[model samples]
Target chain A: MLSEKHLPAFYALGALLLIILPWILTAADSSYLISTATRLVIFAIGAVSLDLLIGYTGLVSFGHAAFFGVGAYVVGILAFHNFEETTFLGFDGTLTGLIVLPLAILISALFALIIGALALRTKGVYFIMITLSFGQMLFFLFVSLEAYGGDDGMMMFEGRNILPAIDLNDRITFYYFCLAIFTAFFLFCHRLVRSKFGRVLAAIRQNEDRMTSIGIRPYSAKLLIFVIAGAGAGLAGALMANHTEFVSPGLTHWTKSGDLMIVVILGGIGTLIGPVMGAFVFLLLEEFLPIIFHELGMDLLKEHWRVVFGPILILIVLFAKTGLYGLIFKKEG
Target chain B: MTQLFFEQLLNGLQLGMFLFLVSAGLTLVFGFMNIINLAHGSLFMIGAYAVAVLTNLTGSFFLGLLLSFPVVAAFALVIELLIIRPLYHRDHLDQVLATFGLILFFNEGVSIVFGRTPLFLNVPEALSGAVQITDTFSYPLYRIAIITVGLMVAAILWFIIVKTRTGMRIRAGTTNPEMIRALGVNIQALNTTIFVVGALFAGLAGGLSGPLTSVEVGMGENLLILSFVCIVIGGIGSIRGALLGALTVGLVDTLGRAFLPDLLGQFLDPATANGIGAALSSMSVYLLMIIVLIFKPTGLFPVARAA
Candidate 1:
């Protein structure tokens, strides 16, 4: 089995690659790769936050995209108002990331608190369904916001959020900006999982009744982690809105939540770095699978790549029980 | 206004029937097999596609609908043996992931074969006309037929589940699968049978409702989520719960959309009212599910000894 001792090396290697990737892609005249790289990093952030719930706490929340969407919409809606020179709920729009990012995190945390409070009352499948419903509720809410473009979504006209001393419009700069945020979150989550609170979460996942018997109420601990995860996802969402330069209700869909889960599982559920690796692999497959199909004279299959991808996902779940991180790093189970 | 209200009520009932058909299968699978089959929607989607193609081929919507049951059953049988059987012992997370993959496969596969454009069917000639309920209002015969079929299926399902030998074993399996297996019953075959039956109902709903809506890729997904909400509201394993939950969700959703905007317009400006109403109505069923779950976490009609 993989030893935890080697994880620091893996983390260092992964971070080094990310740091140097822009130069490598630019050197190869594949600077477009930076765009995809940025997305993968942003999604890695979302996937890692999800891992906190699914892996550490054993809460398989299916509505996680709600926070992610809320964060993106916070940026998108603010940018929309800035473009129109109007106020949203009496506040003038601002493109400043310093303000928008924190606001996004705060609002998403609030959403998580409300949803978690109601949803935590139910256990197992009921919790999953309630969270899914809440996510769908948020999705539909955004879809009905005609002022912000509704189903079609809204775009940022003024470009990416303005950060002090950061030129976000430059691809490499934005890529580095995203990379820096991802690194900070990655380290924070790493420390968090080793903390006393994190051990308690792991204990709760194993035996909630036992945890309760020991005088620790699982609800507050679980709810706290849920809020933290939501805040993290919201930060990712804010970055995503800037990266894509647009926001839509689709971001909050249950399918998006599913995608984040898939990424986490693809890497290795419990490992924070696993989701980041999973994001790298997933985005690569999405980018190149269609091209690979077309090269093999399966032009019809190019657009229908999901037909192939779906079975791959099934096979992974069925057989690759430990995911990619475990596949590469673990010597044995 | 009364006529419009009546028509919307029927619409709600019609939608409720669809929800029951889908949720009946979902709840049974979840209850008995201890699996959450996200691809149950794919089976429903296939049923609609089957009806569309067969109806066009045979020139009779009824014949098409009848044939779709067997087609969907066969599909369900294959899926159960190859995929679901292996997952029966797995955790909910694994089952969810696998079935979600199946959804993507089936959706993309359908689109590849049928093309992205949605297929449509005309209502069967026999039920094409409307039945007059009053001087000012007439309800579509096809919709009424859907409701009748839904109720009939519910009755038949109730009989099979409550009165028959098979029903006895199913109830036993849900509570104590190991004991049932030890009791000399072929649990594998029993599981397959239940899965096929569930798939049949979903297919029947798809075929019957195909003409009322466009037969398109991913159509079953929206209905699947709604039915999931119904299952959550009604109680996961109880057929009676599924019925109550389905009807409540269908009614709330339809009525909310139909009258919420106008009702709001009475007090607010039309534009804002319409926007808020549309948003709220879309969320109404979910809100209802949340409220119900908050009050009765087990659902309104939870089955005792559910897996």
Candidate 2:
């Protein structure tokens, strides 16, 4: 008899089968659709970072975008003098923008350290609101830096500083780069879940107090994961800036944060690949609604795509409460 | 400096009053229900929309307010019954997500219903002028009226909670729901009333803010977050805490924004001062919140006895 504890890998195989549907999406002449899909994957990376904290680690953070925004803004500020500013780090201010990923990751990890150090002192809703406040502080900081575009975010004139002489700005190259990053992040996340550290995180999630009673200080582990998650989000943000060639304060808005949370919850949080799947569906819907509304000639709905999204969110919460993955595949205890 | 100080004081008070009105209902519902209502802000948004549209249609702001509160409260009651009540025993995580979804739906619904352009809620001619507060600076008469009305609401709310039989049960319900239920009190009825009251307060606040702000989509979100901060500071379930939190937040935010830049300019370069000042100004209230949490995690007046 099937038990409540375990799900088969066939579900994941099915997921992999669908993720490549984007090849068909490239039918349009321009890489607009592909890039959009790429952008969604980037956000999925960030969402997955959050899911690690929120879904599996049992911590709800409303400020993951702080890491993402910081990552984007770092690139924007560094590349200020150069429109397609590549390598100042290694190649005399002429490196490809992709080469700057380490810098973004490091900075975001540092931020998570300060944030997590203070924030870990609180728990429950306090944790959520405190993280949110930190994000707001960073948001205001970015908004105040007029030189870096202030409320109006700076547009990237060039692609990332790629290493090894790869064509960094090429759309296809960046698309594949994003795909590789997601794959690596997915695999990395999968391994982490099955590792000892992952088990500690899961144990903490199931019950932190009990974990504490057993002599495992959940705080250190949680903070460690927080840094890792921040690094993941920062990498995603870097890729996003590279992919879109634009970065804005909208990157740190609370609503954007909410969307990430929704994606995490929607994708079946604990499932390794769920966040990416959630992001794909989310962005697809985000794209599809406007086109459908336009085709249907509901001129009013052309701009109200979010209205459609909101009810869909409600329905997901109400009916498909386990999220798409959970609805399809039950988790093992 | 005195004049500047006085100006900041008034600004803080005005901001505090607005927050107090909104947070009153939020804290109560959160306290009694243990449910985090992210959609409460949507209810606030809807209330503002209703008040704005009705005021425009009827050409009577007071009438609009009169009609708006009941309708908003009713909507809240219906939501509680249809959507919220059943989820009471469900996981808190589920409630948070659902309410979050509600916020999205409502924001989009408003966008669809009302054109994206910001709606202007015209101040009534009756309250358009200003009352002189000092030499060189006279405050708007309508804002003064708003403060006065807010104060009156606060007084009545205090009386209702402190004096009435219903208030007694509500207070009991907050402290020990099991006890209240065991004593034959219908918590369903109480929860509904609390929800209605919360809606009414939010609606009134929305109606109040309509004239001061551009009434439009997502208007309630900022206010909602601020009010949550207020409730947190005030002690989530304590009405007294909400009031104090509102005042504290109001003062810090308004005063910080009004003068922090100039204060910094005295010591730093004009541009650097402005940039850093703006950041600090926006962060003052949140800074205050962090300090509060550090000292008093449960807040100034936590209602629930145990965790």
Which candidate tops lDDT? 1
DockQ for all candidate structures vs. native: 0.89, 0.62
Could you tell me the lDDT of residue B76 within candidate 2?
Answer: 93
DockQ of 2: 0.62
Stretches > 4 Å off in candidate 2: A1-23, A26-31, A83-99, B134-137
Best by DockQ: 1
Model 2 TM-score, 2 decimals: 0.94
Query: On a 0 to 100 scale, what is the lDDT of residue B60 in model 2?
Result: 98
Task: Assess candidate 1 and give its lDDT.
Answer: 0.92
Instruction: Please report the TM-score between candidate 1 and the true structure.
Output: 0.98
Residue range B1-307, candidate 1, lDDT tens digits: 9989999999999999999999999999888878899988888899999999999999998889888888999999988988888898888888888888999899999999999999989988899999999987999999999899889989998999999998998888878788889999998888888899899888888887789899999999999999999999999988889999999998999999999999999999999899999999999999999999999998998777733
Kindly give the number of clashing pairs for every candidate. Answer: 0, 17
Residue range with the least summed lDDT across 10 consecutive positions in model 2 chain A: A1-10
Query: Per-residue CA lDDT of candidate 2, range B257-292, in tens?
Result: 988889999999998888888989998888888878
